[model samples]
Target chain A: MVKLINADEAVSLFKSGQSLMIGGFLSCGTPDMVIDRLVQTALKDFTLIANDTTTPDCNRGKLISAHKIKKAIVTHIGTNPETIAQMNNGEIEVDLVPQGTLAERIRAGGAGLGGILTPVGVGTDAAQNKEIIRIDDRDYLLEKPLKADIALIYATYGDAYGNLAYDGTTRNFNVLMPLAADTTIVEVENFSDTPLDPNQVIVPGIFVDYMIVRNKHG
Target chain B: MDKDKIQEIIARRVAREFHDRDVITLGIGLPTKSIQYIPHDIQVNILSENGIFGVGSYQTEENYDPHIINAGGVGVTIKAGGCFIDSFMSFSMIRGGHIDVTVLGALQVDQEGNLANWCIPGKFTPGMGGAMDLVVGTKKLIIAMEHTAKGAPKILKKCTLPLTVAQKVNMIVTEKGVFEVTPQGLCLREISPYSSLEDIKQTTEADFITDLK
Candidate 1:
């Protein structure tokens, strides 16, 4: 059973130097309230896993701007000047993974797979130091799975049991992170006692450990 | 050729390559513009790497939802029966080779059909997004760009900048002409009506087989 908790309690799980997988594309589909709470905390040295660190004022970018994130595994960071500045100055470590491979690695983590074989970064700098395996005479890079201490996700609807339903592009990374983390927390805009339609539910309640209702007035 | 006209011609030519029911991914910049020129008769599902499948063209500002956007962060509508997935599933369609064609913008395409478009050295680059995956996973890859950058030939003997993916381009569509990548080298397939073979020779630095059929 997924327990409903307030934002502060949800973010309290975060600690210094813990790896976190946050769900968002830019700012959309992000657990902003949780992020705001995380910002309020003095926690630092976070290793962030996300699609992109958005603009300075945006969700994940706020963390980057605050210098809370020590390392980031992301696909893109061009939109945020702060992240670029930090990366260039050696203030933060940014490992820019190919977007597809990043997704598959997360998926592998969630699915309990050891790793995936992909040809995406072959012959490129992105494949540096990675093992390449040949199956049937074709080379594929072995990308290890990615997991985290906690995963933060956003949803349009969540039931008392934490069955989650996402809306639009907001569903991007939100749906995958929950499966790959030790503790999965979802921030939902709407919550109901009744379960979401089985077909409508993107992430089942079994994967979710905690649910936070998004602050309505904020 | 007029600049806009050249873009239109190149877009229209690329649009012709799209067939009905093809799962296609369009890169940012000029490739995204190609959607407007896509023929009305053929309905291709435009996949956005940001987790959108069967994406439609730009939506009116009045009806736009800020959250509903394409891979480029522009508001867009979805085609009938189209659905949304996460970036993981979106790239699964890409890396799993479920996509048919990917039209990308290129900075330089070498004689061996290699592409270099993501960045220019000494300039801050955002890093590669889904370009590397698309180049390898899609069945066909097309490079859509202007023939020259500030009058410097982009079709080169070898890419001076970093390579996005090696020897993966199947076709190159430029304002001046259309080229097909082959084992021998780039083959000139179609010359733009506005430009001539001499114009191509004057601007193109790479050796291309003049096999105009």
Candidate 2:
């Protein structure tokens, strides 16, 4: 069952040095209310797993610019100059993963697979020192699965039971993060008493643990 | 030629390489501009790493949907029969060798078809997005870039910077010419109307086999 909670209460669940998977791409699907609440917390040394830090004044980038993030595993951070500055200055440890590989690793974690065999980084520096397995004379890099303590996702519509519906591209990572986290919290634009349409529900409430209602789009 | 004309020349030339039913992906820089130059008769599907397939032309401001942008974060329309998916499925199409071709921008392309595009040592790069994946996964890899940057030849004998992938590129298209990466070596295929064989030799640092047949 999913419990409906406020943003402040959701923020209370987080602690320092924890790992989090935040669902967003350039602020489209980010949990703004939860991010706003998390910014007020004194938590530091948190490991963030996301697409990008977004912008310096937006979403996960706010935590990054505030120096709350100790480490970030992301695809790009060009828009967030603060992240680049911090990375260059060694204030934040950045692990840049290919966007596809990052998505598959999270998918693998949720699916309980050992790891995925990919040829994406074969001849690049990304392949250096990584395990290579050959099948039928072709080589692949063994990318490991990834999971986190918590996953913060945004939903356009969610029920009390936590069934989630997303609008347009906002469904980017929100559908997958829940499957890859120990606890999944959603920030939603609409809170409903009745269930969402079965065909419309992209994420089943079973994977979701908590919901924060915004009733407004970010 | 002026820089914009150079880019236009490169874009127009690169657009000729596509076949009618090719499932192609284009990178953000010069390759993205190639779409406008593609022949109107050819029917090809354009895939975006940001979960869009069959990406169409730009949207008007009134029709713009923020949640419906391409990998480059530009608002685009979806072609008929185009479907939306998450990143996981999109990459599956890439890494599973389902994409027919991928066109990308390169910083440097060596004689052996090695690409060094993601970074320049001691400089800040946003990091490799889907360049590595597309190069490794696509059946054909086409590199579209300027002939030179700041008076330095981008086509080189050997890339001085870190490589994105080694010996993966199949074709190279520049403002001045087109080169094919054959098993023997880089072969000069076509020269632009603006340049001759002597001019190409003078500009490019890489040793290419001139098989202009």
The complex in candidate 2 yields a DockQ of 0.66
Residue range B60-115, candidate 1, lDDT tens digits: 96877866888777788888989988887888889888999999998898999888
**Chain A TM-score of each model, in the order shown?**
0.97, 0.97
- Give the TM-scores of the predictions, in the order they appear: 0.96, 0.96
Error of 2 at A66 (Å): 0.8
Clashing pairs in 2: none
In Å, residue B96's CA in model 1 sits off its true spot by 2.0
lDDT to native, each model: 0.87, 0.87
Looking at model 2, residue A120 earns an lDDT score of 78
Tell me the lDDT of model 1 at A111: 99
**What's the TM-score of chain B for every model shown?**
0.96, 0.97
Cα error, candidate 1, residue A90 (Å)? 0.5
Q: Judged by DockQ, which candidate is best?
A: 1
Structural similarity of chain A in candidate 2, as TM-score: 0.97
